[model samples]
Target: MNERQFGPELTAEGASFRLWAPAARRVDVLLDKPHALRRGDDGWFSADVAGVKAGARYKFRIDDEIDVPDPASAFQPEDVSGPSEVIDHATYRWRSENWRGRPWPETVMLESHVGTFTRDGTYRAMIDRLDHLKTTGITALELMPVADFAGRRNWGYDGVLWYAPDSAYGRPDDLKALIDEAHLRGLMVFLDVVYNHFGPEGNYLGRYAPAFFTDAQTPWGSAIDYRVKQVRDFAIENALYWLRDYRFDGLRLDAVHAIAEPGETPLLGDLSRAVGKLADTTGRYIHLVLENDDNAAHLLDARQDFPRGKYRAQWNDDYHHAWHVLLTGEAHGYYRDYQHSPLRDIARALGSGFVYQGEASAHRDGRPRGEPSGELVPIAFVSFLQNHDQIGNRALGDRLETSANPRAMEAALAITLLAPMVPMLFMGEEWGSKAPFPFFCDFHGDLAEAVREGRRREFAGAYARYGDEIPDPLEVSTMQSAVLDWLSREQPPGRERLALIRKLLSIRQREIIPRLADAAFGRAHAEDGGLLMADWRLGDGTTLSLTANLSNQDMPLTAAHIKGTLIWGKELTASMAPWAVSWRIG
Candidate 1:
């Protein structure tokens, strides 16, 4: 494992602490008594304290002024503003010592939020639900950001401390135990990390090290200055910390397009190369995914001549938008871009990787979006019907199950789960839990009011009709409402949905996974009356085909064109019923 360049390093005698505070004239480690740190020419402050041990709580006093938690803290016993706790990573012994992780092609991801996954809403609480995911045919458990953020509850994007696991969820060991138990159950865990900007509050880097950021701005806050070597290393080491210490199988970098690194060696490529080196050393399949709206196909291209690192896949928003428009017929916001011809967009997404491959987007006021991605392998796209942003960003946080027709929703689900692309499900999507995942946080005072009013302004359409019915993002009740209802799985409708999902996933495991290694896009087309047909050439020489009628009206089935044995959905017939989907293999 790569030695962490930030945070405290433990030895037999005690611990050595280091902080990168270039702008500060004096820096001190606040333990039982103040210990002055020696400043280096490179702007690093270091102190080796003999008595500082694993459980000691401390903070950094900069220029005899404000006290701040370690930017690379291992654990925060309180919240982001509290003292950082020194955690000895060597103390936790792994039960799955010999585990090497599963292949990328075997990934069937379930994106979850720890605070909303269960009523208890802790890392240990998530362990009990592993069996549910395993039986549901979910192979990878992808968690939202867990970095230490302000207050007790959050959707987790507000993380300020990059290294520490949020104390709101559980202690460091509690999170390790969750991963340990998951590996034992044949499951891989992936984490979503934010690198573009920090949360709105509890970030004090500006006070001590203004060099960390530039004048550039992101949607959330100031864009990080990755052009600086220290700034670049800080982000890179954070990625290694989660994978090396927490044993996460992969990381999904949230919104890489927003990461403003205008340098020859971009942070994305460097970070991937460093991770690739780690994977080479450990002999583990450490996958890296990106959520880039730019749809830069070169980052995912496997045939690169240079040593610049490549990503495993990208979260395909095009697929979700196309499917959402087809099922619900909502054309507001970004949905308007796909509403013109949703069936054709869906076909393009399924056949090629991106729907907007160099096409002008109406949402961006006719600006071009995305690069050509047809040559990339099918597994390079992570397709999903619902994710955290699609569900929680709504004014009411209403799930698609509450609004869309059941048959249409089912058809979308079948296509998503069994397609050549990798599939991901929202936490409660399997059993169709109707719980709302509204945006929630624990910020107080002016920030709290700002968030509540900002949400209202963001969804003016919904607010105009619903008026005060929109949930407040700063309220405790808002967070509680997002909790998954486990009992729903036992209900008749839930049971039926779960059975269909399980059956589709079972077929994927038996018939699809083994052939996804090098699967390539074949072709896809859309006809009038919402009829769509698509197929792919599997890693083996077999052909996998899909035929669906997504409209309310029935359409004639061209059975002669689809020459394969039935694998899922209805058998071949003269005409396809409304919202009917069929899959075949030959």
Candidate 2:
């Protein structure tokens, strides 16, 4: 493996190519002309094409019959269907040389889809908006996946070309420039990667290597065969490629619960170890986060050595679901369990890392799920009220601000930012941008209609009343509607909401960040009249208290222990207003 490199490795004279296709009897490198490749050990093939340099277009031919793009292509200049272009990754002049990156505990991540983040939906355009993110108190920019997919616009989870940066965004150098600019501003960039399954279209890997996928079913498609050495190599190397070559600070793996590992040593566990080692060699602080619905605590276990354990955090759906149900008062589908006791779920999420720890989930057909995560640090959980899945997957893609309860939205903002755990904000969420981030895609013909029908069928069970309201995923308007109106931030409600977010972030940095080490010392307790209270002492012995009234009426704090000057509130009042939140420091 060390002797041969995958993809096109260009030198001054020519480029060398290597591919793994165990099923192919013959493989050829397709340059200006077809060049036959000599077989290597372990069903691998290699060839050195003279006069083929950087910027050259090429593909690989299998058994002199089938022609396809390089599976490890670094830049798909013509989207997914066109030939792959050779990228000279080392040529980019990076300016973030001094940037060492931030730790996970300090990560205030702002999640954004590249295509919808800016009006142009390109890397350069998004870079123009970095100043806004930096000023908003974001430490990291979590970009939705950029891997080349089948169309002009997508959420990027349908990426079939694993290595290439989508052409719709920009060229390979353009992406590197985006990361370089972000690092120069002292903001670490984290990419969201989908490894659970390949997209339904434009994937050609199964033709060359059928063993890459297993019969195990995933929500997206077939599960990856992680037990196979080559499959593991592909996944892990892709991770290191982004971290080492692209200079990303971290990665947020999407839907890792769908990743099925055949052995005790899980795919994530191995990848974590490899990334840790890479961090050591590069002398950079790289973090890994997971988006798993199962609340897999073992992934975040710090007790185990480097590779065996040590993911920085997991996206906490428990906290979001609790907040969502409480704010909206909607009890449907998976939210049914939380409707009974939303605050209790919130309290459990605050006190421990998991709300359903070792408890039977009625939503999962009474299956016992999750283990006790009370021993984990508060930063182990990433909390948010709005994210891609929470908002875009909705029937109408309405944001939290669209709900009738403004006070609850404000309260949700307060708790999300002030909590001891790491906080994430979806794009345009800070100012409550009116744009709807609906589920949108760009597959054509019969595939397009199938996607539309499948999406409606998905929500038909939970939101039957709004079945017809669900937008077609394949329509171009659906994607266009999700684009943010950046000008809205200058207006009335947008300006007001932006101010609130800025204030919350400012308070969090000034008060919460300094007391992160003491986070585990906090406690959550509820009071009468739908009041919730959480208290903790800072390093300076100053007690910071958060009181929230979830009910639709004023509630007085009757606890004898409550004695502090109100530090954060809309007005000076003895009783908390409906859905109001107050912060007190003593």
Candidate 3:
């Protein structure tokens, strides 16, 4: 482990530094200036940087090659096309000393892109908004991927430089400050990361060394060459850098199904194992959230063969698809598979990890995937009514809030927040934000033109509604419309509805979270047109049930079996109105 910034000395006393070079054969460590020494055995070259400190720079000398950036460099302001530098973790005065993570099962996630969350579009600026989140009762904040991508702006799926943090979100310290403040506010931070594929433009993988990517090609581009030893080491090291150095609580691995790695130990397992080991040493939680459409629930649960599994959760897309189809009634593409959704489907995802478990799917042409066996129930299977892809994939980039009936939106919101699974609130979904989330980019010239064509093609503008072509995604207006306007619209109906959201989340935190770990799901019942209810059994023989009526007319249930208190309501009236919910404690 040869850390940069060690000038004359041999070994770093207080700090630990490591790099991955499985193909180097003989890795050597060298001090740049007038130092007259070379590295030796242990497979790792060393140096004592007692006299030296951060800001000084050096790199990994592999085989007969010259200095290269540390495989886990945090700040590469010089650009991945240039050089890398050392960053000190102790420098950031994190105020989260008293903050430990909220328990796993009690998670209520909030997802938002850094660029659209605020006007400034920087991490430091977002920290000041933490109090607003705390009031909303969100236990965790899931930031979209911030890994190095072409320029500064992206969906983060196109990130090319795996190790470097993007410059647009302020310096590396700015992100640290944001995470530190989030922890101080008792909010866990989960960063979305792209390891599936690298972006096409500004990508220098072929320039650095030829072995970075292999013959495995994906829709985005050439998939990373994980079969090679150094490629695996590079990716594994990047995973550790975000956890061990940056102090991020967890990671949402973007599109693991697209990433292909065939090895003695699969690369996904390798990455998970490395993170798990680092978490054991740090006493801090490092959750790996893999995004898999396959619905393999065992990844979240601990398995006997894959002992290194530390997957905390995966986004339950069925919950969103069903909720969206029912609310918006727009059936196209993958959303086509989901038919007239009953409220029972949402309840199923909330209670069980998945809704399509062994069920015959008209979409897949066969029975869909199943969830994990009863073990590892502690892991959270997150569900939502809307997410980035859900909203942005729409032809108009319209969120459900923008199009769905307000009553329907409120019903979706209530079901999402109160569900047994961990809930997620998409940005702007809270205030019923009207801003559109169009697929936007800032790439200039030919790159910009290429992006526009690719998006329109991927969007599959088959509908006759848009005759010739869709507007270019590279337009500034698309990005402009994506920004969240925080100024409250609470003068009229917005006030009570927004208040209801906060109140519902508050009830969820205070009431539902305490016994969230218990898997004893009571009966979940819903009608064909109007209402949905799930009865959750608390250990004390007390039943907690969430009931909602989404129809235009008031629904009065005369059932003798269900009885409880009025724990929450989406409406402002004294009585339970249409589209209202009650968290009855029976």
The positional error of residue 396 in candidate 1, measured at the CA in angstroms, is 0.3
Model-by-model lDDT, in order?
A: 0.91, 0.84, 0.68
Candidate 1 — what's its lDDT?
Answer: 0.91
| Best candidate, lDDT | 1
- By lDDT: ranked, best first: 1, 2, 3
Off by over 4 Å in 1: 301-308
Give the 10-residue window scoring lowest on summed lDDT in candidate 3.
2-11
As for candidate 3, its clashing pairs are 9-48, 10-47, 10-48, 11-47, 11-48
Report model 2's TM-score to 2 decimal places: 0.96
Index of the highest-TM-score prediction = 1
Evaluation by TM-score, superior candidate among 1 and 2? 1
Clashing residue pairs in candidate 1 (N, C-alpha, C atoms within 3 angstroms): none
Ranking by TM-score: 1, 2, 3
Task: Look at candidate 3 and tell me the lDDT of residue 190.
Answer: 86
Per-residue lDDT of candidate 1, residues 1-586 (tens digit): 2297799887767889899999999999999989999999789999889977889999999999889999999999988899999988988999999988988889999999999999999999999999999999999999999999999999889999989999888999999999999999999999999999999999999999999999999989999999999999999999988999999999999999999977558999899988888787898888899999998888894322222488988999999999888878899998999998988999999999999889899899999999999999988899999999999878889999999999999999999999989999999899998999999999999998988788888978734787888998888899999999999999999999999999999999999999987789999999988888999999899999999888888787664656799999778687888999999999
Candidate 2 has its poorest 10 consecutive residues by lDDT at: 301-310
Q: In model 1, what is the error at residue 113, expressed in angstroms?
A: 0.2
How far off is model 2, as Cα RMSD?
A: 2.2
**RMSD each, Å:** 1.6, 2.2, 4.7
